[model samples]
Target: MSMDFKIENVLSMNGGQTDSSYARNSCYQEISLRILQPYLEESIGQMKMVPCGRFCIADLGCAAGPNTLHVAQIICRAVQKKYKALGIGMPDLQVFFSDLPCNDFNLLFQSLPLSVPPDGRLQACHYFAAGVAGSFHNRLFPRSSLHFIHSSFSLHWLSRVPPEVENQMSSSWNGDRVYISKEGRVEVAEAYLRQFQEDLKSFLRARAEEVVEGGWMFLFFSGRAGACPRQQGGSGAVGDILELAFKDMVCEGVIERATRDSFNLPFFSPSALEVRELVEEDGSFLVKKMEFLSMDTEMKIQSDVDFGRMVAKQFRAILEVLIASYFGEHVVESLFQRFAERASQNASVLYNSLRQGGGILAIIERACTP
Candidate 1:
């Protein structure tokens, strides 16, 4: 792994059902999933057949939260609809929720409904659920295992920050910034792009070996609408505002400049073109639907305060553990509080940036051959 960020050891969403946990803050993810419903149903409808007796579905990077089960439930519903429309019985489902080993499977499983409902109302479709702990960058299942695979708001996270970005001796060194920014060096962006390409290539290769031919894969993750990663502000705006927060702490001597410089997040938001090129290069999957979606525009922010708090809480749920690991838990709450205040002041700009740095939904079908 590059730097101190290890995919298996360091990456995981904030667990539990607390006010600050990922479960509460994942409304944004739910919106993305809602947007995905039509396409998911379409994919299922197009699939004229599924495995004979049991259908295996895996939700990769299924972080701890209701969203995790929400994704599975959506797929099960779609599958049920498809079977009902075909006038055939739906196959038994073996759903796997896969995430990093550090994830809270306990919370995820506990969130499942009672096995035997007191109301005696049976679920429309029953699924045998299991949690698979591992990184999706590698193979998590046996050969030709998964019949349908879905991942939402994941995949942009690299297995690690590019090694060169952390080396002061390297030209790509990203000093005092967590991600690629307008003020950052082009070499730094190039480093991130290379890492993203490498990680994506590995991801496709692994999934190719695991998914059966003709199975479907749906992926939704952050992306840039522009052709060039440097052309638009996308996720860079978040990095910029976050750097501002860190600078505030630095000025107060709460953290050293070197401490901030040494820290970097393992994230990259790719362009739609970049994703298509990578998928075509991999040659294992045929793109069925690939489009850039603006998730922020769909959100209804009543006021600047609400927008600020929403953005701050959304990011805190994702970055709280990583930031606390690097900067200590003492500063976590104050840092995010300052972030919310700063975000409120720049609500308009932040909204536009987030819209530009929207999400990408790609529905691809496994080809007959790699």
Candidate 2:
């Protein structure tokens, strides 16, 4: 299916090198590892009794860069350690890193470190990077081939901005272009839910084909509180601060209200129940674990200054891509001016506000089916 939106560009923007933010923000990777470790252990335990054969692990929605591979390396090392303890021979393993066609796979491939030896002989770790453009739900990997499937900080992105929001049929947007209208709010929430449902189905189907019958799948994502989107906070405190910044831009006429409204970022954070329903509906996977934490745990905002800077950097990156993609290259200066003006005041207060907004994480396993 053709994507109505430029998902690859947005993903690139989201994945830009924000070393401080990623390092400081433990929620995405740290918490994800916590949930993933057990499954890895269990999968490795099962692999120990089996005959030496090829083992496959896939990182879906792996952005075109080192960050994706960085995680893969960690998992590989963990699995290797497990086998070492069990005194079982290490299985030949392959790591498949996947993302969209527009992603910089060449850059990712070029940056991979040279192969090292796990034994006296060369390590049998094979790296393959492929682009699975459209929706990841459709086709990700071959059926019954994946031993483990891991995705973190990626699933929340909707396949497309809800059609209702695009048509302006919903009242979510205020005259100021901020999403203040109740109808607009509901519309955005519904759109996200619908997109998530479709995406989840595709994800399950694809994984069902790729993963071995008893293999494991772990997914960690940002989720909202409560059943409805309105019940939750913004995209952490930083996102709220950005919204405030956008408001100022609108008031000063630095950016058109419609321009802001036309910009769509579709992210959904489902509650535990919502996630359970989504997984169970597929009847192919079982919910092994699920956890929801506030923004503090998810994003790891230790201080107001750090929080402010993190939010600022993310907005700056997002704005850079949005300007290049939607408006033309020339409008970046004006956009930066608007961002600067909005972020200059009461940084501490804005940071505190963002800390109040948190996110969620989840883990699942493929149930052995007859």
Candidate 3:
């Protein structure tokens, strides 16, 4: 770990607030899954050739929420239906829901479905859900253990911010900026890029060891459709624009100027090409499908209601913990309140940027020959 690194227990999502559970804001994730439903079915289809006596599936980065089980159920159903169609006895199923250690495992465990109906062609499937506490940047299971791995709305988060950018003592500090954006200087962007490269390699290497040959991995996360993620503003890439909210608070005296300068999110938005290049070089997994999924941004906003608040809550559920760890909970709430106001006023910019934002869906298979 870098001496300047501040990633760990400090960063976590809001633990399912009454109004802002991950479930509510995860519509983008849900839709991302649905869009890749066909590819998911295809990945499950691989079991026909690979022996699956005990199928193990993992939903990596599964925050505690109403939507986490939905992914697990999909995996269970797919595996069950595949086995049933072949007139073979289904294998025992183990589903791992993984996330950072501070995540609300209690909430996630509490929300699991008591049962799941058959999917595709099975009668019924029984799945045992295990809450895995660890960062996906490191290994969490035995080698060749996982069969189908799925992660959504995650993985864009680097295990830590770039040491160069955060270590102010060094000449590589990102200055006052907290994330990659137009505001970030060249070195700042370079620091983020370096961190992303290192973290991504670790993640791919770790997953490569755990997944058996012919096992499939499905990853869905926000990404820039453009070639350069460093420049900011990609489809579904509203991450950078959120900095405006921070600026608003700073100017309004709601937060200290130094506070905003020190805060930097560990998030990184990778372009499809970046991921492709790394996976290709990893020599562990073969890319089966990689494409961008568009989000639904055409919803008609009621003139009376604040549309910005609606969107801010979604991000708040995912980001509040990280922000609160540094600035405290009170500050977190105040910041978002101001964010909601600004976001609503700039809704037109958001809507226009929607076309530039989209989710990357990648289906990869552990090389059978490897």
Candidate 4:
């Protein structure tokens, strides 16, 4: 499908703790970094021991702020420390923070703190942050320019929602909220799989060009476990809870059933095997390491009261945005208020249901050919 990515619209809410902060502290970051540290160490070892030369690092899908830079900083320091232990001077590094055009670059720039030492020893650090503004499948940087590329909590977003699904009027009416029945689940899964294939091809091609040989790229995203047709008990609980919540909205006539089915959330959690296959399929990159960790969404709640409040708050926050986008901004508050009442009651049941429905974190690195 020829998809025009509305970068600005998608990132309209990408600020504050909700956007960058939440991701910063997410388990995905913690897990992915653990996998990344060694590869970074090895890469630093291979590079010429230049004491004052510039090294390049890029964060793809950097979003709008310091969160990306913060992660980059951590990586840089770790690499520098590794070199310092070898009695090597620090290399001057150029860090690039890239995202879609619609991202709030002004906010990111404003939030960026100065990176100089008090004594002005020229910390050997220079930053070049910009909005790539186009799909990652397309050209974003020069070939072989990047040493390390990183992205997290993205990649599942298709270049566009499947055009066939978008074009099919009947497809839209297939679900109430996010619930996909046996057949509906199969169809939707196929569509998502197709989207992933297409997007991954483009993404791999683009990165293969930008990343230098032996350089690494780390990606952390959400995906499902096992090959289950219908989301049910077990690891499917989050899907179930979201399905139930959407059904409540449908029953209340808050959203068209068609919209729910036709517009699936732009995310997927691939199995570790599935990820390995993707990495191998590209043939340009080799799978260095892949590990899956169970991440419970329920961990957001510390207490019963907090759980209740979080359920209501998350529902309202998401619903307000959805209602405002599809309906009118005027009805957003009212719609969310009504949804919050129902969400509070459902929170306990949903929390229990999803007690085991955590997420997965995967890290892939670029392989160096002999």
Candidate 5:
């Protein structure tokens, strides 16, 4: 409902293929992509009704870089492979990579693969990729134009800080905190919950208009399983880590305490029931699969990674864009420095919190009519 939260205001990921950047920190995104790969293949492969012509696919909130297009290619290849198996010429394909305007499109295009020589492959020369700069909270494509829509690790963000929480005089203001903690005010928590519901519904409604009847969408983001919004006992959750660092900064006179109190992150983590309710209420999507899984449970522990640094890279990539925009560029360096230090200080606790972190994977189909 509120458009004050412009996409350009947020920060983009660490650009380029640098080893210490988001390219390396984004392992969890890869893991999520794999989890949804089979569904992409099977659903698109088996679609008997998709019109035989240019097929449109959009990856909403596709942050800049190789990985974004890389995942889309995986889905694209699966469809082409299926068409080849059926002894038919492949349809023309156009992919829309939509994200915030601040996203590094130049860097992403630089990373795009030039081309695979046409060895008489199924979809050779049939695929075209382009970046569409905008928020997924609004319509990004023409009506009934998309065959598949995919978004990962993006939807939990609210469009803006709720006005109730933003009002200086309101009791709901998230003072001295950047998020709704276990000890947060009830009104603060309720404002956040209300904002998420509104934003998610708007997203689904817009996508419903853009996607064709029976078209599929796969959504993966951080979500909790139980009835509560906050995951109990996970004190090392990124929100907690950030808050801890903020507290330390306050005590040392680096940043004024009121500054931290006034700044609440424009984000929330919904429970499974909450996600389901929003989808059902939208009335234009049929819920197919709703799963809440632990992010680290599926991982095969890699011996090489320094766990604390790995986690810090991801948090910085995600929050840096907004933090730098609101807090100032000078604070960015020291903030993440402190974030990594805090994470390393309690390695066991931090790793356990990550292991216990919740992720949601939901597959929904657009109804022909609302």
Candidate 6:
């Protein structure tokens, strides 16, 4: 089903550090960040600073949480380390935390550590910080103004669901599923792939204008191991489970069957080859390093119920707003409750699936001028 892709109005993580907030349930995201840290440091070491003794870094899709500023701190320290090794004065850092205006920038900023000395005496690095609210698919910064860009687990979100998927008469119509799955039609999967391609091209074009020549971008997103959507596995286990929950709601008459049929998720997981080809096709960035890495959960679950609840919370933190916006706020808790029950019952299988799951990390550099 199709809905308005009004990201600024509908998309955001569950805010604050409350029990269900993204900040508390983002352990998996934190794990991904750690996996990418080494790559970030290496990229910083190779960066050619923009003139005038300043460095600008933007973390796109920086949802509200400890992970938001956590990225900034890692980046600042890496740049600092590079400068120290070169025996040069470190440039003033300007960090931008960007996301849709609906993001909880208030909580993100409030959680930032107290100011440290500008001289790098009290910490590894220190600099200015600000928030920019807008879709990264559009131009968000001045032309050639940024030195580095980082977007984690954000690129998978399409600008909107493909229009064809919403038209009931269209061959690409995605009926009864929130995302692509093993049972999905070939035409529907192709529609999603095409949308991802267009959205990715827009993202590259915008960043090409904003980032300085020779700047770097380190990106991470959920992806399939194979080139096509249906290969490897399918959309994802979590997405499948979520769909079943919606089905259960429909069976119980809580939501009409048409309602379930009309709500499609605006997300796509591309393969690494797909990402590389898209970047090369755009003719801006040179792919530096591309690899797949798995995110291991830190929590030790004592039982199936605990594991199920943990998984449910993670999805809720990231997806509650999007789901609630389409299905109504009252249905949100009940949906996740159904989700938890199913997940707990299949805990062992889910755990094994998660252990085998991984994502793509693409480190690309803005090609230098001739």
Best by TM-score: 6
User: Which ranges in model 2 have alpha carbons more than 4 Å from their true place?
Assistant: 1-10, 14-49, 64-66, 85-87, 116-121, 124-134, 171-184, 234-239, 251-254, 294-307, 340-359
Q: How would you encode candidate 5's per-residue C-alpha lDDT over 1-370 as one tens digit per residue?
A: 1235453467467656665466666877777666667766776676644437777889888887657877778778876776678877668777888888877778777777646447733335346778898888888888898988888878887788887776669988776777777777778778888988999988998998998888888888777766765453332167777888888888988878777776777777777688888898888988888877666644444432355566677778777768777767888878877887787776676677667776677788887673
What is the number of backbone collisions in each predicted candidate, taken in the order shown? Answer: 0, 14, 6, 9, 2, 1
Q: Which ten-residue region of model 3 has the weakest summed lDDT?
A: 116-125
For candidate 2, lDDT tens digit of each residue in 134-242?
A: 4575676667777777787678766655555655555533233233122345755666677778877887887777777667776767675566664444443334445
TM value for model 2: 0.78
lDDT of 4 by residue, 39-136 (tens): 55555555533344656777777764444656776767755765687787666666777766655566677776656666645453344444456567
Scored by Cα lDDT, where does model 4 land?
0.56
lDDT of each: 0.83, 0.59, 0.74, 0.56, 0.74, 0.83
lDDT by residue (tens digit), candidate 6, 1-370: 3444465578889987788899999888788788778878888888765344778899999997877777888898988787777777767888899999889999988987858766654455666889999999899999999988999989888888888987899998888887787677888889989999999999999999998888899899887777668543423677678888899999999999987887787888888888889999998999988876666545589999988898899889988998888878999899999989888987876776676677788999998767
* lDDT at residue 66 of model 5 (Cα atoms): 54
Better of 3 and 4 by lDDT: 3
Quickly count the clashes in candidate 4: 9
TM-score of each: 0.93, 0.78, 0.89, 0.76, 0.89, 0.94
Predicted structure 5: clash tally: 2
For residue 317, what is the lDDT in candidate 5?
72
Put down candidate 3 lDDT per residue, 225-285, tens digits, no spaces: 6775566554223555467778878888888877677777777777788888888988888
